[model samples]
Target: MESRRRTFLRIATLELCERFGFYGLQSVSVLYFVRTMGLSEQGAIMLWGAFSALMFGVPVLGGWLGDRMLGARRTVAVALALLATGYTGLASGMGGAAGVSLVLAVLVCGGGIFKPNITSLLRHAFSDGDDRLDIVFTIYYMSINVGATIAALAIPFLAVHIGWQASFGVSAAVLWIGFAVSLTLPATAPPPAGGGDRRLWLLLGAGIGVAFTLLHYPALAKICIWIAAAAIVLIWIVLYRRAAPIWRAGLKLSFALQAEAILFFLFNQQIATSLTGFARDHLAGTIRLAGVDWAVQPGQFQSLNNLWIVIFAPCLAALYYHAERKGRPISVPIRFLFGFVLLTASFVLWRAAALAGAAGPISPWWMVAGYALFSLGELLIAALGLAVIARYAPPDGVGRLMGCFSVFGGLASYLGSLVATYGMAGSGTASTAGYTHLFGNLAALSAIVALASALFIPFARKMDAHWRHAIPRPSSTDKTPTEILP
Candidate 1:
């Protein structure tokens, strides 16, 4: 196989631009829902949480289509078009209607398709497996930051001036470009699909699905409750063990990283969701600094995280690579633990910044500092997840495995919304004590997650070592004859 595909750079740049558009809107979505759309705290958080989760969730459906029927290119075109439409519609400030909610959901569905397949295509571009996988993901992650940085700089400024619609329109245009560029890239030979008899596979799939329904349907909650209980009681992840040792280990490590990444995304809702209240209650004055003016708005601060992501991602990636060159054990899960710990530190610092702001209008720089801290965490955890998923998945299961990671992302966002709700109740400028209390809880939670991850690392490393040989096998379904793809 040639070292790399000719089209890799083309795909990465376009995808990065695409990311900018999505995050541009996403960064400011909470603010839009509350301020312009007239949503309450409860309404905003729930919708935002659902939007975040569902956005990740829809990809499962998209992956099903991509792997089973539509193929990557077609699925991507359809999904990106849908995402573009969703952003444009949202830019209309039509967010107040039921149609808008459905539109948002459609965006979620579109994401399921567009997001995963882009990375899938990128990896598929290269003939090698896991060799350059980290770099591949890092490249993709960098694209996400490209958009993030641009969106960060633009959306808040746009939202402050022409309103959400115009800001959203800018994103819509970027998406189109992404779509056009993706189409222009060279195509690959679709790997011959390998599996058992189609008829038998279908029957088994249907039968098991039916059996699952029969087992879990009458009371869905009860089924999940028992499943969780079983996993906990067994002292090991039950459903997971059936997977081969390497995959099981890598997946565990991936989950730990994902848990950290998803939590960051979940907490990210606050920047857009609660910023209006935060700025309104605190911050002394606002003036026109850069053609746009917010008399007093914390929402402008949302851009700081993206800004830092844009500036620091390349640097951090280099640092990681540099460390790797020096024979460091910068394994994926270890990176996740550090990210989690840093995130905890960010909240702690945010509280201190809030306290210091009491004496005067806190420099928007404080939020920037906090965002910088979080963005560092993002680089380590969230950024690495997609690549990890691609590199480690059993060949036939790429889409499904990515879909699983997406589900975890959604679950984390959903849970984060709940956590954010409680934090917001006491997080504004209205009460100093409430604000202090808020960050304290956040720090505590971060600490706990970090601790859990540290404990999980040795196990992750052990599993990774054990499963080293089994990666990227051509067919997971061929039980007796394992054909490893290296």
Candidate 2:
């Protein structure tokens, strides 16, 4: 078990590194489109929405392949290959929108295969009923934020310094690195309960990784992510969960989980949506420290959010870990409350920035303040929820459930874009009024989120209890086929 833990850490390092590489490429995509692609601010929001949705939406398909067809190992490698191709096309500027759209679509789908599979692989490292879950999830959360931190710093600088296409090239490079790592991994990675080791296949996979990195064919990449994704889908069919009498409780959890996930997803898109715009438009001239440069771009402020995550994820993880140990306060519902509260505060920062913009450049600290608050909110609900979700859902269908988790975020992003479009479209040019309408609407949404959450507390507080009652507890007379006790 200790050896497996060590190996899991190694894999986590590589996986997080991959995440950093990918998000670094993604974080500044909106800025690239707005400044480079000549998209309207709102149009950029829409693009962001589409991008986010596709990135998330593809996971259902990806998981299908990972579980049913290709398995995690092949699915991840092939997805990486496709990702590399998409970036190659993006960097070389080899095609028109149609071509690029196809490339983007393929890349998005590839993400579906890659993202969830990678996450699922990490999660599976902790077995059913493992007591170390909270700690393990915290460690996993750190990697997520660490990747985000890198993305926040790297992508914006790359985009600002080079062309958008070149910025995209970096994404390809990251995925290639991930592919290199993936190939070397022992097939026992999601470790077979009982199995044999095959080093030759690992080396062969490495060669393929090198070859594709050398190749700049988006077409090939798309084909690869697609095939890998397709393979996983077929595999999923093979592993599809069978119905059982106890599944009713699990199904109820799934429905609530879907709703819960969507709300958090909406919460996350703020980074790409209003948050980015707020930083860029309002903070270029403010936020100076004696030794630090305030000349940093708006997008750069996002780095602070990820940085705080590094500081906070482990702390929050520890808090919950201890709470669980003592049988005291920690649980999903309470954590979710914090999420709503923090998100509300994030909007307050946006509101403050809007109010202050009339004076001069809104203080960059305001941006940091908002992001920090938002990140805090996310940690409580958005971040920890991923771990909780795996816990609450049926183990047999975990990937598909996670896929829904990813989709919830996409749906929220899509809604945000739609809201932003309609919220801003009817107004005049991007003036104070335009900003007002946008910020004002976001504020309202944030408030509603808070209120909705507060209302849910009474119901959610009873969830674990309700769930316990809803299912049978193990005892002498009631020996179940599986162990699913709290």
> Model 1, stretches more than 4 Å misplaced?
1-6, 93-95, 128-140, 187-238, 244-264, 274-281, 284-297, 383-401, 423-432, 455-486
Name the best candidate (by TM-score): 2
Q: For model 1, state the Cα shift of residue 181 in Å.
A: 3.7
- lDDT per model, in order? 0.63, 0.62
**lDDT for residue 231 in candidate 2, whole number 0-100:** 57
Residue 43, model 2, lDDT: 62
**lDDT tens digits, residue span 104-215, model 2:** 6556656667876786666656657578776677677677777777777777777778867787787777767877777765452342332222542453344334333322
**Candidate 2 vs. true structure, TM-score:** 0.78
Each candidate: how many clashes?
A: 5, 14
Cα deviation at 213, candidate 2, in Å, is: 26
lDDT of 1 by residue, 228-317 (tens): 334433432542565666577656655555556666666565565544445545555565567776554455566677677778777876
| lDDT score for residue 178 of model 1 | 70
**Per-prediction TM-score, please?**
0.74, 0.78
